[model samples]
Target: KEIVGVTRDITEQTKLQKALEEERDRALLYLQAAGVMLVALDQRGKITLINSKGCEMLGYSEEELIGQDWFNLCIPEEERDKVKMVFEKLMDGEELPYEYFENSILTKDGKRKIVAFHNVLLRNQEGTVTGVLSSGEDITERRTAEEALKRLNEELELRIAQRTEELEAFTYSVSHDLRAPLRAINGFAQALFEDCGEQLDEKGKGYLKRIQEGGTRMSQIIDALLNLSRISRGNLTLSEVNLAEIARSIMKEIMEQEPSRKVNFLCPPRLMAWADARLIQIALTNLLHNAWKFTSLKEEAVIEVGERKEGREKVFFVRDNGAGFDMRYVNKLFSPFQRLHKAVEFPGIGIGLATVQRIIAHHGGWIRAESTLNEGATFYFTLTKGG
Candidate 1:
């Protein structure tokens, strides 16, 4: 009888010990969770338990906080008012629940830290508020990041404004000051040739002609550049546009200008678009004209205008069998005065593509180009559905 009673007692003790171990393990696991910093402070604001995150946040070890007064860390002599309201609420029997407060706390190394405190009332089994449990989250990194980003944005805005002013000044100088001298050079050269052509040799006459051509080309380039600049700051007058009609008009104009070149323009019968009508016309004309000029060497020049639904995006491509540039030059293709072909071969200021890109971007669309040397080039872009 005695042996049996002892075994029974041993079994009960074993079960009780197992339950205690399980409870301890669970408490440890709860404290290990990263975001939640479990803490326990007594009625006197004395520190009882500080979890891993709590210690890490206050930049201290649990050894330092335990048994120390927690409120002393928060309410400095000057800022004791921080908790005066908290105490008032507690005295009112209104269990002051989780409240957010930001303050500095002294660390194990005797350094102060600014942390966000989320304090909640901890009650006993009798349903009486016994102590406060606070969660501390260190937001130093986040604050630093936001401050840096704000500074960067401010700097970028200032730089952009300065750059815009510089561009306007340059444009004003180029339009008025630079053109006047070029006009004089060309005009004086023409007069010189008209009066002195009879006394000049073939080479001399050719030199004068070259001077006139250079001045004329330079003027055309200036106009193209100015047009590109206007695209950025100009208000777009949007309207519905029939891309097929625009393509046909551009094709006819090109054909009339260069009738000897055999060019085929395949515009889908029903392709319509929503854009600035005049701007769209200009963009399409430039693209079509570009394709025509690039393919001047090919006996069979072909250009296709078509649209397709790509994933959630609507894409339109202008494909041509032309003297395409190397793909490596793609980045430069949309920059002002950036060209792959010599100005003699392609009579452009290289601002056409830049202007086209600007218009497409203003419509909240993107443009891409694919090409290979001597093969062909295809330019793809998107258009907004309606104005």
Candidate 2:
């Protein structure tokens, strides 16, 4: 009976030892598979175990690293004392200042590398701290890239500010200096037609009329340029604006200008958005005016202003049955002075869509257009709270 009992005890002990060995093998496999460095140190800050990644990062083999003084060997001489003191205090039951931190370590090749480490205190069965287990990731390349990108962004911002100042000076020149000569040209042309009317022939009068028209058109173009420049320079004052009301008012103005034109304008009630009210009004006016102008030849003209949901985003759209443009030229639609049609066909300086785009961008929004030639066009936009 005693021999059978001893045999059973030996069998149980063998099974338990095999289970422990399997668990240890599995743990070693996981440590080796880890991408980041995994390291364990004893209470005296001597390396107890280190994974393959840790050995690779330190430019040493696992056999050379185990049982070595971690701070004296891996840490820089300047930081060695401070790091050792902290580890000693942690093993003596004091809490660490931080569980995660970044520091520089010396590799075996004598190069310094930045490591971001997450550490935990390893404890015994009685809850006494045994040592520290740390997982460290090499972040030297990422930190370097981030610093370079930051400097690049600062340089870009400085350049943008300088360019804005230069543009403002040019705008002032166009507003004051250019307009003075333009006014004189228009004034003298009108004087020539009025004062010398009886003396001049019909051809002379026609020449004066053409000169006046050219000066007037130049003034209009200047005004449009100034308006486009101003759109990008201002601070936006945002409020809850009723887009439906603004659309209705714009359409009303267009209809009043050309009372003979019969057009159908449809706008939903209570369409609201958070935007700069004045800027939004200007954008809507431009879009609706374009729609009204293009639909002039349509016998059954229809324009609609409304909003719809695209997933979680609310998109507002201006749709028109008008003399729509070709999709191939849509890429140039929002560029200033880029006209898809001739000036005779569309009496515009071609700054309207560009101005609308700037306004929408200021409001942290975007705009896009879709059209089929001679069929219709739709301008979709989204507005959010402005900065």
Candidate No. with top lDDT: 2
Summing lDDT over every window of 10 consecutive residues in candidate 1, give the lowest-scoring window.
1-10
lDDT of 2 by residue, 1-387 (tens): 355443345888899999999999999999999999999998888999999999999999999999999998999999887777777777777666757778889999999989998889999999999999999999999999999999999999899889976886688566767888999899888887778878988898888888888999889878877777787678888888899999998888889988998899999888989988899999999999999988988998999999999988899999999999999999999998899988788788888999899899878899999999998899999997642
What tens-digit string does per-residue lDDT give for candidate 1 at 1-387? 355443345888899999999999997888767575677777776889888888776666888789987767644555556665674465344654637766655665666556677777777798777877777776667777889999999999899879976895688567767778888998899899999988889999899899988899888877776676666566777777788888888888889988887887788877777788778887887888789889888999999888888898778889999899999889999987888999688777787888889889877788999999899899999987353
How accurate locally is residue 310 in candidate 1, as Cα lDDT from 0 to 100? 86
Q: 279, model 2: CA deviation in Å? A: 1.9
Task: Score every model by TM-score.
Answer: 0.67, 0.73
Cα-based lDDT at residue 12, candidate 2: 80
lDDT values, one for every candidate: 0.79, 0.89
TM-score for candidate 2, residues paired by index: 0.73
Which candidate leads in TM-score?
2
